[model samples]
Target: MSRIPTRHLGRYLLQGQLPRKGCLASSNYTPRGSCRVAASCSCSRCLQPFSPQATRAVHVSTSSAASPADTPIIPLRKKLKDEAKQLKKESRKNKAQKGSAQTVDGWELTVGIEIHAQLNTSRKLFSPAATSFNDEPNSHVALFDLSIPGSQPLFQPQTLIPALRAALALNCDIQPVSRFDRKHYFWWDQPSGYQITQYYEPLARNGSITLLARDGIAPEDGDSVTVGIQQIQLEQDTAKTLAQPGDARWLDFNRVGVPLIEIITRPEIHHPRTAAVLVRKIQLLLNAVDACVSGMETGGLRADVNVSVRRTGDTATGRLGTRTEVKNLSTIKAVEDAIIAERDRQIAQIEAGGSVVGETRGWTLGSKQTRRLRGKEGEVDYRYMPDPDLGPLLISEDLVRHIKESVAHLPDRELDELVDRYGVSAKDAVSLMALDNGARIEYFYNVVGGLGKRLREAEGRTPQQPLDLELDPDLKKYAPLAANWILHEFGRLVTDRSSPQDDETAFEITPEGQCARVPVASLSELLFHLHQKKITGKVAKELLLALYHGNVGEAGGVTAAIDAHDLWFHELSEEEYGALVESALEGEDRVLKEFGGNKKTYPQGKLMYLVGKMLRLGPTERIDPVNAEKAMRSRIEELCGTSA
Candidate 1:
């Protein structure tokens, strides 16, 4: 038998590039040059053609004519196909493994988040230049921001107020003494050659946030995850870099030197949804405390997510697998999806006999995947050094105490209170808190308060006193209904009528601007009338729109609006209701034929259709849908011979 080099033999078999002659010995063990396996001929010694196992039995001879270096390179497509096959085989094996069904292909994912939120301040962090988001390019740049010679860093003390509020809101421990350091990096947008940031000593550290199901973040009801805050650092933002066509770029200094607060979280999140929820929770908390303008849409906030995956029972060295960081995830959905995509990518790489590389990646919305951006940067690469101009920051205990006192309850806490105090559902409470930054929540509370006062007055009790909704059943029943009206009816009306604005200036200039057209008292009166059955829900909605569009004057509140529009709910007598029902069903033979029977079941759709026809036959505002349905059901039973 003649021998061939192992590399040549394997490459030939794998690529199907075997020479037509003398590729393999025949079943009779002929000389190498006399046999061919490409045809029907087979080699008993090598088992089969193109089999990976055949490579092991083939012996390599030093006397072979071709050296290993002479072997042909594998094509990219072939390599990809082989990798895909390996990955699929491994996936199937994992599915068959013990406990695979209990986990994500028997692999666990861990994630940590770093968030950079721009502080809501009028001036830059170190320079006195004004800070604005949509201003002209380079208009807000200060001399110091330009990094000209002789320019010195001038620290702004006011920026710390919001930073301190953010730290307190996040439950971080405030550091009495912290200092700024220079993070050295070369980028066109960063003209200073380095960024002034709190590195060695951040503003705060070791805090935590508990995400509750009521907050609508957890995967299941009654599930709560408390993620620990690693640190909160004060930093300066880089200028905006816009890529132009043909490899050109535009730099906007309007965002240069903007104050930023970086909040880092420990690697505690195990699910993609939870990670996204944590980012959203932080944005809400910061917005609630007036700490930062956490608008992901406006680039006011950004998140970097670190994702890694490990086998369920892999305990070697008690270390986790290498992780990849997905950077600059602007939206909450992107954060969750990037983590999931990166996790799957790493798992697939590992399953295909490859190792996960520690690198930086970017999330592509078009493809919904994460692509490699660059290798991850290490601490040493930044070349951190203390800023020469800025000294150690010293905070007085009085200031910390004052800031802590000023910091109201975070969104999660407020959410809990809203659900527990009022009879509102968890879903409704979350919606209230999210709309217009709790402005709607306050409106809802005012409406509830007004209703409570009215109830007290009707009971001949103290009308000006506060009442516990939990103890008073009448007040409890109205809270959820009030939430529904404010969130659904009133909120929808205002949102549709109000023109979209580029910034929050309209909301900030007049906090009550959105709700000013329709007063809380008007909504309170409207909902009260709804509860009293003086008007149906449909009529209430009409009155709401009327009040919003100024068609009805707000001088006398919702009562005046209803009267002006003649939207008062009317109840018909039995005779009148029966006549209307008969007229509605007079010509509708198909509806009756399909649904008419002595069976107990009735076609709800056809019944409602008849009720709708009856409503259209008369003044809808005057007809209560409940009464109309009852009248229609009775008339149908009489005509059709049974109540179906």
Candidate 2:
């Protein structure tokens, strides 16, 4: 017999064979037990006894009176079929009640993510030095981060409150009592032997985030995925390390002690792409709530992708495969790469009839492969006891309720509601919200709403202005028009601050107040110019590009630019359109002869080109092509009558 010492919950058990009392050799072997007979075994030597739990049927087959040794072993196919049927039934029920989920590899992907987002706080966890990202090496290091002798510990409440807000925003269950513990580890950046983290009592738990998938998915379509969130806890981040080409790894203490919130999810993710999309949604949510800065690329938000490939039928009955944790994946592309590589690795191993090993690994972007880093073979003993320096934190129900009410509505949810309630198309709604420039959407609504007010005020006034003003009510009624202008014409005018230098005219965008980098005011101005139609859409784009490139006002009023560009496009319009109409009338004398010869089929294409050319002269003009065509057709009819 073999004995394996294992930890069940918090208790340690020494089972099976033993050598000398002082010897550790005998207890180290793999635990041995057969699945068949162990179901009824009461030895307690091999089986760790369970509490008198309710019994589940232990299936067995009875051989007939014929040769019993020749009896065939029954396959477990029936058991598998029953479970699959139950899963299908449950899935259908859930689809009707909640919604259907996006599945990958024939199994629904349940993703539980613990996002360790670094907070933009001022000081370290236990230090007094100013915490900043790009400070000199060790300059921001306090004695506590340095792990120096005689350095006592202190807590900062400023970091804690923002984390509280984040928890509430994610709809997490805030725990009444929470405390920190030391996570034992050794690293160059971590001068302290252990990292301070929450073990038993996290700050929050049981949260959820619903991500809207792309395409025209109506509420009745019933094909949406809602990922379950497990928890979001506050912890401290470690230091930064820089390695020189020929030098040893250098450590920077500037980032040490920064407050971080780890957002954990239920294993509700299956597809790698869906996982990436979820991360993007979380990033948007955090930004919408002002909980974190928009910097997923700069280590502000990082991902530790845990991937495992199990048999298609295993997950239904709680059977799981050996999982590998891929660390240090920064980009969504890297995530896809990791998933593909890991899936291939698992599939190849299984095809070779080998069992997969559970371990931690690191991704190599260059070769696109995952290499083993470490294994949690015997379970890690972080010795996780509550931190003696920090006392218990009591979060009251009132405090949680307050945070909940204050949490800003997320853009994704708003987009969804807009699509469902306001009849906004999924495509247009997605365009307005998916980008970081949500303020543009807000300004659009404002301008459109203001237009409606102005229209109402004009109803009673003589010689009133056009229905486009700061306080217009008609604009509110024309929200779709506002959406179209913003999405098409107005958006073109504002340079995407994300790629400013690409265009010579775009303004230099910098991070705003440690939040979004783009300027919301720029979008507001563009929308304002569009609503007033002072500048044509084309000229507005040029002006916006120039403004983005730091050009304020070299030209006169916006109407002047519109008038100026109208001339620039005027001659081209006349030449192209007049030539088309004249050529049609002159070359096809038959068309001219049509009205005189009593023939049908007027040259509609030629007439349309003339009208289209006129409209292209300016976006703000709103000239009616139908009316123009009507005037042209009447002149042609009169000219034919006179010639005849």
Q: For candidate 2, which ten residues in a row score worst on lDDT? A: 9-18
RMSD, one per candidate, in order: 14.8, 22.8
Taking the tens digit of each residue's C-alpha lDDT, what string does model 1 give over 1-644? Answer: 76867866876766544543544332334444333344443466433334575424452222344544576678768888999999999988976742222137678888899999999998899999999887778888889999999999899999999999999998999999999999999999999899999989999999999888765553532478899999999999998999999999999989989999999999988878778888887887888898875478778999999998899888465678898999999888888778877888888899999999899999876455798889888889999999989999999999999889998667777777777777678888887876665567777777787777676776688643546644665656788888888778754764665555512322221234235566667777877888888888877787877666656664777787677767676788788898898789888998888666555666888899999999899777678788889998887777777664
Pairs of residues clashing in candidate 1:
602-644
TM-score to native of every candidate shown? 0.71, 0.64
Q: What tens digits encode model 2's per-residue C-alpha lDDT throughout 524-636?
A: 44545554444445655676555544444435533344455462322224434444345435455554555564545555665565455445543324333444455556556
lDDT leader: 1
Model 1 has an lDDT value of 0.79
- Candidate 2 Cα errors over 4 Å, as ranges: 1-111, 214-222, 364-368, 376-381, 416-536, 550-557, 563-644
Worst 10 residues of 1 by lDDT: 502-511
